[model samples]
Target: MYRESLKKSLYDKEAVIDVHTHVGMSPRFFRQYGYPYALSVEDLVIRMDMLGIDYAVTFPFVDSAFYVNNTGSSKIETTTEYCNFPFELENRNMLNEVNEIFPEHAHKILPFLMFDPSRETEKQADFMEEISEKYPVFGIKTASTYIQAFVNDVEGKGRPILEFARRKNLPIIFHSSVHPEDPWASATDIVDLAERNPDVRICIAHSARFLEPVLQKADGLKNCFVDFSAFIIHCKLAVQNSPGIAIEDFRFRADYSDPLSVMVKLAQTYPDTMLWGSDTPFNYWIQKYYTGDGKLVEDRLECGYREETEILHALPEALKAKVAYKNNLRFLFGQDI
Candidate 1:
């Protein structure tokens, strides 16, 4: 059924935009976790074509080859002296590569400039402004946790970039987390930021790590959106860790073994604010799961582009249309395509 639906959508030339994806290299992931380091425009386009994705909003890998120590650790070490601008190289490379190498398919690839607020905030914003004029920069992407900054720090470290986005009318996608220790980019902080800057469109990446706080208040803020990239993995982890715990006013039990149930319920509840994203390359890796026999099992999460497409295809026609593409158009372009 999903394949049939996908084929029809493809034949109809219906737009299927993935709102969250990464490109470029991540030495940290490669060195520490043995994940694939390089993801180029060609690589992404091949996967996007295979998945029948019409367009994808992509940005450079947040963890560029700058940091020395693990970012997840208490102490972060960086080769700051040698590389003052964090994502400058990667962003430039992405824009140039798309424009020069993939000129014919450049329209299919929408690149967002990655921002690092902790280092030369004003300079980085200046660079972004310059690039927006030169290239088709769709929006801005920032991970507060990577930079050890606060998303709601409007008057302090976060102000310059926030101000830039507002002035340029650019949407910002933040890498939010549900981890207790990583509160810098929590859904609460992102919501606060969205409330404060009502004009700037803000997307809480990864569905605020699938927490309930953002889902509870998403509809109230017109400029705020959420993407469920890597949601199945997070949901599985949450269920495994806290099977019976309620997700803070979510009005649903987290005890379900199937993560798709939670995803469907949330999407049905907040269809307007939902957007589809794959978090590709990373999603291709193997994942561990506990089987019914209580034995730990290692396998892929079985929720990649094809699986996600199936889930979306299973939705009611109206809701499926919105989550699969319409919401992305509204969020990124301020209109439906």
Candidate 2:
């Protein structure tokens, strides 16, 4: 029944499934900044309803109490000013709470759990295995940068986590960056891991902030996929057109990437691996985009993801639909529809 019902949302329909949305507040928010606003699961449901989004693959905030942002990375300075990095409110049980309210809503919200594998590698794996079986977890996320892991390798620091994923049929979404000193996981590291575990599905999160090294590594690995979740062409255009849009959110450091040009090339060359994901509520903000003359216009996360059709003028309807919906369902879920 669920699979059949899902067809109504897809089957070449222009349905969108945002795979990178977080709900609820993280721990340590009050300590870093007083009176912080969080994007609750309820807020996400309303946004999806208003935008006609078909489904959102959601996750819990990282329980980052053990980790702090003293890395002095440029990305850290910008985001940490407004954000406290996800704190220690994350675990498998937290995700279960979100699904308790899933069925009452119109849109389908698939939830995933976040973990830091470095604490007790073996225990973390066991906990993941248990909850994955007990709950309806679609996948697992490794915010390596947030978790402070070196890479996505089984032999390296994340061995226990990677070993668990290698055996299980579950997919892993790894936070990747191309920077030499990413302070998180690197794209090169993910590529190496994917080569060793060909059967395991891996998503190189955020396109490694548009690092070509990842794409080069993904060339031979069929199970590897690239995500345009947090940053996309439309997001860049929105900032460029609006004078004071930076005031809305500089959390995402799309400093060098031309997401529009890069997206077009990736969609054409690696169409199969390309997937759409909204780093929601993070990206889903009420940003006032002003014209050249400073005339304000109402544009928000509701309109940003549709830039391929509305703004970029490069992606045809068929290709646009593929990037937005088909690519993800087919590749990730192994479903043709």
TM-score per prediction, in order, is 0.84, 0.71
* Model 1 regions more than 4 Å off: 1-13, 70-73, 80-82, 242-256, 284-305
Q: For model 1, what is the C-alpha lDDT against the true structure?
A: 0.70
| Backbone Cα, N, C clashes tallied per candidate | 0, 5
Tens digits of per-residue lDDT for model 1 on 163-237?
888887778898876655455667777877788878888898876666666666766788889887776666665
Name the runs in model 2 displaced over 4 angstroms.
1-14, 28-30, 34-37, 66-89, 153-157, 232-261, 284-315
lDDT by residue (tens digit), candidate 2, 243-331:
31222232233332455655666677677777767676545334332232334344443335344233223557666677777777765
Indicate the residue-level lDDT of 204 in model 1: 87
